[model samples]
Structures are given as C-alpha cells and as structure tokens.
Target: MRTLKFLLQKEFRQIFRDPSILRIIFVMPAIQLIILPLAADYEVKNIKLAVVDNNHSDYSRQLVSKITSSGYFQLQHFGSSYKEALQEVEQDKADLILEIPSQFSKDIVKENEASLLLSVNAINGVKANLGAAYLRSIIQDFNRELRLRWIQFPRFNPEMNIETPSSNWYNVHLNYKFFMVPGILVVLVTMVGAFLTSLNIVKEKEIGTIEQINVTPIHKYHFILGKLIPFWVLGLVVLGIGLGIARVVYGIVPVGSYLTIFCFAAVYLLAVLGLGLLISTYTASQQQAMLLSFFMMMIFILLGGLYTSIDSMPPWAQAITKVNPVAYFIEVMRMVVLKGSGLADIKYHLLTVLGFAVVLNSWAVLSYRKRA
Candidate 1:
C-alpha cells in the first residue's frame, strides 16, 4: 500500500512538473470536446441546388419555391437549360439539379401527371441519399396537396384510409452532433493512450533514465503501474470534459448511469495503456515508438467505428473489430450515453474489453525489461 502510494505521488509530480504534459493532460481534451462536436456534424444542411426551369409556369415556380423553402437546400444556380444544370453539378458547384420538363404544367393539367427530372451528385453517397430523400418528401407533399384540392371524396375521407405514424427514440430530432461527440471522445482517448504513452516511455529510454530505473529497487509492475496510472486518470478527465461539452454545447444528456459509463472507461483505459506499454517495450527510440503507435492507432480507430457504424461494416471487418479494444469502448459509450443502455445490454462488450485489458496488461508486465 505504501509503495503504491509513493508511486502514485511520484507519477503525479512528474506529470504536473512538465508544462507540455500538463497541457496535454488537462487542456487538450477540453478543447477537443468543445470544437469537435460542432465541427463533426453529419446532418448535412444548406446543400447547393441548381434549377433548370423549362416549363416557365406557375406549377414549376411553386415546385422551386417548395424545394427552396425546405431549408435543406440552397439555390446556387438558375440554369436556363438542362445542359447548364448538368454542367454545374459536374463542376461540383451544386449537389443537386432539378430539371423541369418542357410544358410540365400543361402535361399535368391534361394527363394528371408530369415528369420532373432530378439529377444528384453521388460522390458523397450519404449526402446524396439525404438530398434525394428530401426532394422525394417535398414532391410527395405537393402531390398529396394536389390530390386533396382536385379529387374530392363523396362520403369517406382518404386521410383515414392511409395513416403513416413515425416515432424516433433516444434522439428525437436526430442531432448528428449528439451521436458524434461520444465517438470523438473515444478517438481522443485512444490517441492519448496509444500515441502519448508510447512516446513518453521511449523518451525516458532516450534520456538514459530507463537505465536509472533499471537499477532501482522498485518492482517492475510498480513502475509500470506508476507510468500507466497518470495516463488512466488523464483519460477519465478527458471523458469528463467530453460529457460536459455534450450537455452544455450539444444539449445531449446521457440517458444511462454515469458510473456505469465510467466503469467501462476504466477498463478501456487499462487496455489502451497496456498496448502503449507494449509498444514502448519493443521500441528503442521515441521516433520509432511514435511512428508505430500512430500506425496502430489509425488501424484501431478506423476499425473502431469512429466514423461509420460497425453493424453496417462488412462481416470480416466486424469480426476483426471484436478483437479491437477501441471498438468495444466505442460501442459501450454510444450505447450507454445515447441509447441509455444498462450493463445487461452491453455485458458482452464489457466482457470482451475486460478480456483485452487482462491480456494486454499481462503482456505489458511480462515484456517490460528491468535490467540492461
């Protein structure tokens, strides 16, 4: 107990004594929590739209007004011809192009149907899909209104015949920031654990202090714990900053117990720190440690569902993520913070993270060299 206390005190002093380390440990996380959530929104808005109004009638004018009023799209180009509109989209000046066919109003009045051509840039698949969906919704609403005004029911109402009720849970308005903040926190914590710790450890070796530690009477596990404890606390502090930003800036409240989330965070910290320790043990220089750590961090984060949903990933990728600690933590954090899931809901993820922590820490302890 005394040894552990002494080691803890020593680690704290070392962390606080270095200005760079102090800033990284205390200030960086807060900055990331505040800036990333606002910048990382997936809910695309103000998409540039080009319009080619060939009909030159009240119906085409109304359709253009409806599309512009939806607030999802911004009218950037008013092309006189379909070729011009297509050129705007091809040049990346517009995300969508609406080409109203010639005599559209007359066709609709005569045949009760008119074809409106919609051309969308599919480079960004998600944004293009959203744009298409918004266009479809606006057109559908217009068609419904036209049906109501033109076709009158004799006795029964058509509204009673078709009822499509929809409800959204957890995120009612589907705020993309709320979904992204937690995932960013996971990425930041992983970067700190893997990249920062590896560099810090290798720095000691480069400075010749590792040799000094090798001659000390302290046990190897105690030294390793001393090195890792500070980083573990730093990770939790980052988590706190992220949570605060979610509540204050993004207005996202964790629906589950904070303690439960912290429990998973603690386990994740152990696994990440253990991986860093393993990296430090193998590398002889800080540059090597940093490069290796960076390579591993990228692979882990990409596989960890930081930007995309793991369930949507290919089966092979999903299977690989099961062995990645970052994936487990990301899953648990999203579930607890966003879905309000309890331990029972994420027991399998927790167990997997626990196993990773055990294996990594065991490897770190065994691999750490105490002698020159």
Candidate 2:
C-alpha cells in the first residue's frame, strides 16, 4: 500500500510537469468537444440544384419553387437548356440538374401526366442520393397538390388519403448534437485513458526509470495499479468536463442520473486503461506505444457506432463490435443520456466491460517484466 501511494505521487507529479501532457488532459477535450459536434453533422443540406425549364409554364415554375422552398436545396443555375445546366454540374457549380421537358404543363393537364429528368453528380454519393430523394419527394407532393386542386373531392370520385405522422422519440428536435456529443465524450475519454497509460510505462523504459523501480520490492500489480489509478481518475475528470461543456454550451443534460454515467465510466476506464497498460507492456518506446494505440483506437472508434450505424454493417463487422469495448460504452452512453436508461438497463454493458477490465489488466500485469 505504501509503495503504491509513493508511485501514484510520482506519476501525478510527472503528468503535471509536462506541458504537452497538460494540454492533452485539459485543452484537447475542450477544443474537440466544442468543435466536433458542430462540424460532424449527419444531416445533409444546401445542395446546389440546376434547373432547365423548357416549357416556362406556371406548373413548371411552381415545381421549381416547391423544390427550392423546401430548404434542402439551393437554386444555383436556372437556364432554359439542359446543356447549360449540365455545364453547371461539370464546372462544380451544381450537384443536381432538373430538366423539365417541353409541353410539361400541357401533358400534365391534357394527359394527367408529365415527365422530368434528374441528372446528379455522383462523385459525392451520399449528398447526391439524398438530394435526389429530397427533390423527388417534393415533386411527388406537388403532383398530389395539383390533383387536389384540379379534382373536386366527393363530386365524381372520392379520393382516399392516408396520413402517417411520425413522432421523433428521445430527440424531439432530432438534434444531431444530442446524438453525437455523448459518443464523442466516450471517444475523448477512451483516447486519454488508452494513449496516456500506453505511453506512461514505455516512457519509463526509455528514460531508464523502470530499472530503478524494478530493484525495489514492489509487486507487479502494485506498479500497474499506480499507473492505472491516476489516469483512471483523470479519465473521469475529462468526462465531467465534457458533460459540463455539453450542458453549458450545447444545453445537453443527461436524461439519466449523473451517478449512472459515472458508474459506467469508472468501469469503462478500467477496461480502457488496462488495454493501454497491455499495449505499454508490449511496447518499448513512446513512439511504438503511440502508433499502436492510434491503430487500435481507429479501428475501435470506427466500429464503435459513433458516425455510422452498426446494424447497417456487414454480419462480420457486427460480430467485431460485440468484442469491442468502445462500441459497448458508446451504446451505453446513448442509452443513458438520450434514452434515460438506468443501471438496470445497462447491466449487460457494465458486466461486459468488467470482464474486459479483468482480462486486460491481468494480461498487462503478467506481461510486465521486472529486471534488477
């Protein structure tokens, strides 16, 4: 116990003394938490639309007005020729081109139908797909409006309409920040825990301090605990700072208890720090530790459902997330923050991360070599 206390003092002193480490501990989370959620938005908007109107009729103009007014599109180029609109797409001025053929209004009024062509810039696939889909929906709505205006209901044949209204649960405004901030908080905490701990022991090795520690009668687990505890505490500190920022800046307060968040975070840090310690045991230098940590963290964060849906992934990718500790915590954060989940709801997540902490810390302790 005495040995572990002394070691904790040394680690804390070393961490505070380094300006770079101080920036990582305090500045990184503040900057990233403030900037990332605002930038990393999944909702696509402001798509540049080019229109080629041949008929110059009221119906065609109304259709164009309907699309632009929907707020998803910007009318970048409005020309009479498809070739000119195509030029806008080639010159990168437009994302999509809507060509209304000649006699469009005539066909719609006389034949009750009209044809239109959509040319999309497929280079940006997601934006192109969503933009085209948005335009199509607006056009369909215009068609329905036209029918409702021209045809008198209950006069000749009554038209049946089925309205399906949707309620957005948890996120009533469907704020992307609400969905992204908690997950980003998880990522920031994971990076701090894993990166710092992985580099801690390796820095000791490079600086010849491990030799001095090995000559002492300290147990391997004691040394590991000393390395783990300070950073584990810092990891929670980062979580607190992040949560406070979420509340003040973004107006996000967890629907669940703060105690629940801390409880999961405590165990989650053990697993993350244990992984870091395991990496440190295998690595001999700070550079090696950092590169390895980055490599593993990239895979973990990408597969952890931060930006994409895990359910949409392939069967094998889904299998990989089951073993990923990051995935578990991100899911738990969303469950607790957005869904108001309690400890009982997160028991499976807690137990899984607890298992990860046990396996990883045991491996780290066993792998650390003490040489006199």
TM per prediction: 0.92, 0.97
lDDT, candidate 1, 268-303, per-residue tens:
899999899889988999889989999888888899
Best TM-score goes to which candidate?
Answer: 2
Say which candidate scores most in lDDT: 2
Candidate 2, which segments miss by more than 4 Å at Cα?
155-162
Cα lDDT for residue 134, model 2?
90
Model 1 clash pairs are: none
Model 2 lDDT, residue 117, Cα: 95
Which 10 residues in a row give candidate 2 its minimum summed lDDT?
Answer: 153-162
Model 1 stretches with alpha carbons more than 4 Å out: 152-161
